[model samples]
Target: MSPAFRWFHQDVSSRYTGLLCLFAGLLLPFAFAPVGIGLLAVPLLAWLFFAWSDASPRQAFRYGFLFGLGQFTAGVYWIYHSLYEFGHIPTPVSMLLVVVLAAGLALYPAAAGYLANRISLSAPSMRLLAIYPASWLLMEWLRGFVLTGFPWLNLGASQTDTLLAGWMPVVGEYGVTLLLGVSAGALVSLFRFRSGYRWPVAVTLLSALWISGWVLQQQNWTETSASLSVSLVQGNTPQELKWDPDARTKILNSYLILSEEVWKRDLVIWPETAIPAFAQDIEKFTQGLSGLTKLTGSDLITGIPMVEKGRYYNAIITLGSESGRYYKRHLVPFGEYIPLGSAFGSLLDLLHVPMSDFSTGRLDQPPLKVAGQLAGLSICYEIAFSSVIRAQLPQAGFLVNLSNNAWFGDSIAPHQILQLSRVRAMETGRAVLSSTNDGITAVVDHRGQIQAQAPQFIGTVLNAEVLVQTGATPFVRWGEWPVIIFAILLLVAGFVRSCYQENQPEEKTRG
Candidate 1:
């Protein structure tokens, strides 16, 4: 190698390479949806290949940790905005806390990278491709399940605008992530090969995958149902003013007026915590809305706090004769309910996020029935979780997400979150109606297309005829259990291969 080439290689070999790759991954999403230019994955796979080529498990773990630190530090920087803006934490404390939390969140990805490196030691070449992708998937699943589950920044989410998005309705986000990882590994393998012949073969396969995805995108898997006209009401209430004693009546009146305008629609929706008061406390208002619903022969679903037995719940109530309740199942950690109460209870009290001590509702609560159809209800933070939404799919014809995005201000966080809601809609083949406080409230079709949307910070009502799906996608029917099984099979296969290699030491020389 030339002197400059050798120097460049050494730089890439340093710990900074992983960090650089992660930063690239973080920033790439802002530039392009799906961020699939493969810049992030390329360096990431290169680091894994080099680590596996030479390094102990402990060393690999350290390298992976550094990579994760960079990834999360950049990706979740917006988290600190909430702490500083709403939690009343000092700027320095909020920054430090966000860094610590990001570091902790990085552990899952670090562990996945460490495992991939270890597995690659015994099974080099294309075998690592399978093991690495599978390992990443398993780690992501764990990240989503363990703790309160922060599945933000999943690789598949980056593919939202790409042709790969066609795979969403089938295998869902994680499956698309697995495919992305596998593609990355294949690309790395191609780069490692000096022979010109290998490049063409790899390129051909990648092209074929892209072509297939495009074909899938052109295919219409489900027909839209013309049975429902929905209006999503964006109250556009400011976060600071939302819970003010003096502003409560004004906030309530704003929603009431908007709801009145949209009452003629088959169904009307409001953002999460739009009422900013307990169901019992707002009985008079609820009754008035119920009466209005009956008078119009339409149903209204609104987000409100439900107090029961001294515990508060972030809940959605259907106001009409067929009224029912759906409490938010997946609460935001720290934002909604603080985890490890003994350790952080005091800190949580210091943070002034209203309604942070919410009680989780029963997992098996029935779907919200509105206008003769069952609507799957997912509150603000709840839509990020697939399993939570999956449980309600069997009975739900459409999905309704009520959110207060004013907490996120004008940041891309709301837009990104809304994208996840779109993915969920595709996964279940159900039209998603999202009503947000401070805009981006949209009516997304089953295919994940936004049919109508209100601009940010605008108090507006969006009217659209939403489609209801009768049939379920494979993902809706089986949920993450199928993905879990696939991950388990991959792990088992990797273990079996490892044992076989131990018995036949000669196979090691083949690579």
Candidate 2:
């Protein structure tokens, strides 16, 4: 029997494989923040390749689904917190929604496993190095775009603190995912390579990826244009009172009072829906804000719902110096705009969500002019999409992300979004001013480092001098196409090779 054949193609499946996958899935969250052992993503993913090495297509599917179940189960538990604690959804329904969302996402991993086995690759290196990662990346890419996408918890986001982040400017997050997948495949090769230079090759692959990332990190993709002094307001408005009529004037007064002393800064940011009412409803107040910002030479950008011809929008408006307005283009399903509302009419009536029907702004909305600079704007959930940030780039000197994560309330979701906004900063080669209601108001520099941040659940202002940058990273110029296309080509090569092996019945007696 050939050593390569025996190493990869085997009947050595174990009884504990299911639990192994389940626990390995559990390891997925630990690889990301709150417990940010970033490199753990390697060993965490290695378990999947290791388990699928000797399983049938059906077994591989089951194992993959279990791995995904474990992953989202741990990763997205905050959905329940957002729905029940803040949305005031019933406990039973909230729990069911969480389970359903996780199960739906699990299908991607399950498909990855089924395809890996269905495509025959007897040669150990080819199977582990090519077919495996490519299959995984393609499935994940699909998961990111389908149904307006939930690109959260993508493996690439977990690599922000790693050397792999150096590659982010050039290839974006999914590219990092592809590279990370290769790293996981190499890890499995280390254990199964048996004898010869395959072990050294696997080591070399990992080292090259790490070294390249570090080397890339040292290169300056964007040049500093100027330093802009900024202040972020953490209103600490409880989600329960955020939309309350009695609390409306008090909330507005609290934010205005907090900014009283800090308006001299170049830019002042407020969290999503900080106004807590329609712009027309508070026209007199907005006019006064415009006058105040102009008097202080500060550009104030805040989230205030705008009503235009009777359509509602979750929008960001700039006042003073040069003004610009951007309505959120990517709306969160059910939260921002319900999907198939009529189909789930009964359920919707029960949930009674607010700001749930926001109309999306134009896709080509230009960046807002603020503080003598142009900045990209993303409202709450919109920051998760790279397109929302990139569309404003080459024109935008910095990025502004406004969110109301009080709904998440002390969950890792707030931290997770903070992490993601930083990734956008890295990808676009632009500074990011991400302000959230209550906590995690932070300023991230062009290199994706946090310059300053406010403490969670505080009604205080976080002030910092942020660098405004010029020029675009490769990611801004070219989106995820390079990585997506590369994955597609790799899968094609694997399929063709698998087909050749099938037609060659007389070729080998390996194993």
Candidate 3:
């Protein structure tokens, strides 16, 4: 083995290896939003791969758990802001809640590590190269699906500004994540085989993965067509004051006055729940706005709750030339609605989140027509789901995301969510107009680049032009299947190879 490789494995068994793993995990979040040091993800993941490959299954689980604990604690610290600041939870309780959540998330990684080590591939190299990568991918998929799926701080999201981002449209977010695991595995293979000729081959494979990303960036998956001028309104309304009966009129007037300045624009968008009243109660107000938009030859989209058959839906409604409504499909747990409400009825009361009971929109809801084009709508957390956004493609030319991030205070949730929006744009090859209640409102181009962004905690308008995209990207068509399929194949191959090797040893002994 190379001297560096030998030294690294030696250090992995050192007394402070657990501490080192935790420190590495803590640094992983920096590779993502707000602080965006994109290149850090690979090396850190490689280090974790090394620790897992060298440890027993029990030790690997511990290492993975510690790494995940650090990752969630650092990356999702903003969750505390929502709980304590908006949910009205006490400081002590909020801190405890954050720790509990982080610990719960950590189990996913721990399970991945334990499963990978338990599989017992014939060779150490195969364990890292095939089994480990598949395990990680499966766990990531589980994290995004099981129990309503947190899906935050995904490794692929860290590559948003990197050359790898170009791969998004072709292979999707999970594909990039799988590739990162491959790169990390190849890197560890270099150390495992440094004394042999195979190490050079490992180095070559690692180089190709990154070099291919740079090459992919030059290709355009979707062509930009007509452009429409749009205005995104940031009301800067405090969460505490938004629903107050006395402040309702003032908040409504604030949006109207801000929007009037840009009334001539092709489209005007308001953040989620900007109306601060149910759609049934605000028909007259909506008609007035609709009339204004019609007079100006523009379309208006605003967020409000829609009441139907005693069920309430968190919806965004179109006014003027286009008339449509899109309710949020993937609702935020506790924040949007309580899960298993009958059994856990009082949990909502203790959490104190507002608008805590909203019915989910139908899965096949059509895209909204606006500004002379078809626009896919994702309210709040829905945009984070690639499948949800992909369903709109080949039909919707642009994407619109409306969010009320005031509940998160001035924490990093808005910036993190903005990063996710950019990745969605890259994945679908569509321009995204992300309108937020207080901050980080911006326009993201099909290339996943932020064109223009409004400052946080400001009452202002972000005026920009977004292009309409006509076709669908490969990711939009194939969805997450390709990546999931690839991972499954790797796991199958690894197990088959292990079985073959075991039989070979037995046959030689019998001969």
RMSD to the hidden true structure, all candidates: 3.3, 2.7, 1.4
Would you estimate the TM-scores of all the predictions?
A: 0.91, 0.96, 0.97
Q: How far is candidate 3 from the true structure (C-alpha RMSD, Å)?
A: 1.4
lDDT of 3 by residue, 393-437 (tens): 879999999999887887778889999999999999999999999
Model 1 lDDT per residue over 259-303, tens place: 776777888888888888888987998898889999998888889
Position 57, candidate 3: lDDT: 89
- Superior by lDDT: candidate 2 or candidate 3: 3
Name the runs in model 3 displaced over 4 angstroms: 507-511
Q: Note the residue pairs that clash in candidate 3.
A: none
lDDT (Cα atoms) of all candidates against the true structure: 0.75, 0.87, 0.88
lDDT score of residue 346 within candidate 2: 60
